[model samples]
Target chain A: LAKTTQPISMDSYEGQEVNITCSHNNIATNDYITWYQQFPSQGPRFIIQGYKTKVTNEVASLFIPADRKSSTLSLPRVSLSDTAVYYCLVVENDMRFGAGTRLTVKP
Target chain B: GAGVSQSPSNKVTEKGKDVELRCDPISGHTALYWYRQSLGQGLEFLIYFQGNSAPDKSGLPSDRFSAERTGGSVSTLTIQRTQQEDSAVYLCASSLTPRGGPSYEQYFGPGTRLTVT
Candidate 1:
């Protein structure tokens, strides 16, 4: 498992775009970058995943640089309901979660 | 379709007691995982079961913690001699498969909140 580092917290307003970055300097070749969102009293939900380059889905977009040392999660037109804790994980088999980045979407 | 379901959403027990938490994974999912989440903290992996293969128990914190998946569909995490430090939310997740790839997306249950007094 690769250790990940992310901001402790972030703040944004409604209808704004929020981007959270995660750093995994020692990522392995087989490791994939996955993002999950967790709301109050709920389990984390998968948002997006990527091995390299960029991957986009109905909810969010994941951008992995060429070096694969870091990745970014882009959320467009965020709303108050988007407030949650975002986790960036680099996993091969075992999934180890870090403290995560808390995004507070204000109204 | 149901994602994942856990039983006994909340449990309060005394120290030195034993407790069991159950998890029902999505139909046909081959990979099931157990995790522990403390208040204001991140998730800690506990155990994993993939199909009929031997479960990976390396993440278990102690001998008191044990889990078993029967028929590859349901799982139960048992803790013996629970202590106050065992008070936390226990979560269960399932995925289509356990292969290390981008397609492995884990669906989590609401979790069981255990409070050991």
Candidate 2:
């Protein structure tokens, strides 16, 4: 199991690409980096997951280096609805979500 | 087409009373998880179930907290003798089981808000 660290908050303008990074120095083998989004008053939902390199989906993109020590979640053209808490999860034996980075998309 | 669903969107119970929260996972999903979130706090994993395997209860706060996934679709989380500290939002998620384990993209339901007085 690995502990993750992410920024507490981030501010971005609409139409901007927002990237939030998480560090997990102790990431173990077979671990996967997963990102989740949680809107206010709702449960958290998975947005994306990756093992290494880059993985992109309709909602977001994830980038991981060969070292596998950190990963970044990229949200392109973020809108007001994209404002929420973004959780970075490193799943090895079990899944654990960090405190997450609260992203605020401003007009 | 339907996402995960939970019942009793809001529950208010007195201290020492027991409460049961229900979760209905998406059809065909083989994995389900339960979590709790307090005011301004991050989610705390409680338990999870995968197919016919025994549930992972390592995250349960205490013996009073138990959960069961019946027929591998619907899950019920029971909190015995609820206390004021148990007030929080209970969230449920389900995912299509991946090759290694339940690490695939998960769909979530609107959480149930619990207020214990």
For model 1, how does the per-residue alpha-carbon lDDT over B1-117 read when each residue is reduced to its tens digit? 998999889999999999999999999999999999999999999999999999999899999999999998999999999999999999999999785786879999999999999
Q: TM-scores of the first chain across all predictions?
A: 0.97, 0.96
Q: What is the TM-score (0 to 1) of chain A in model 2?
A: 0.96
Which DockQ values do the candidates obtain, in the order shown?
0.83, 0.56
User: How much is the lDDT of residue A78 in candidate 1?
Assistant: 100
Considering every candidate listed, which one attains the maximal DockQ? 1
Model 1 per-residue lDDT tens digits across residues A17-102: 99999999999998999999999899999998999999999999999999999999999999999999999999777788889999
Worst 10 residues of 1 chain B by lDDT: B97-106
Instruction: Compute each candidate's TM-score over C-alphas.
Output: 0.98, 0.94
Which residue runs of candidate 2 sit more than 4 Å off their true CA positions? B98-103
Say which candidate scores most in lDDT.
Answer: 1
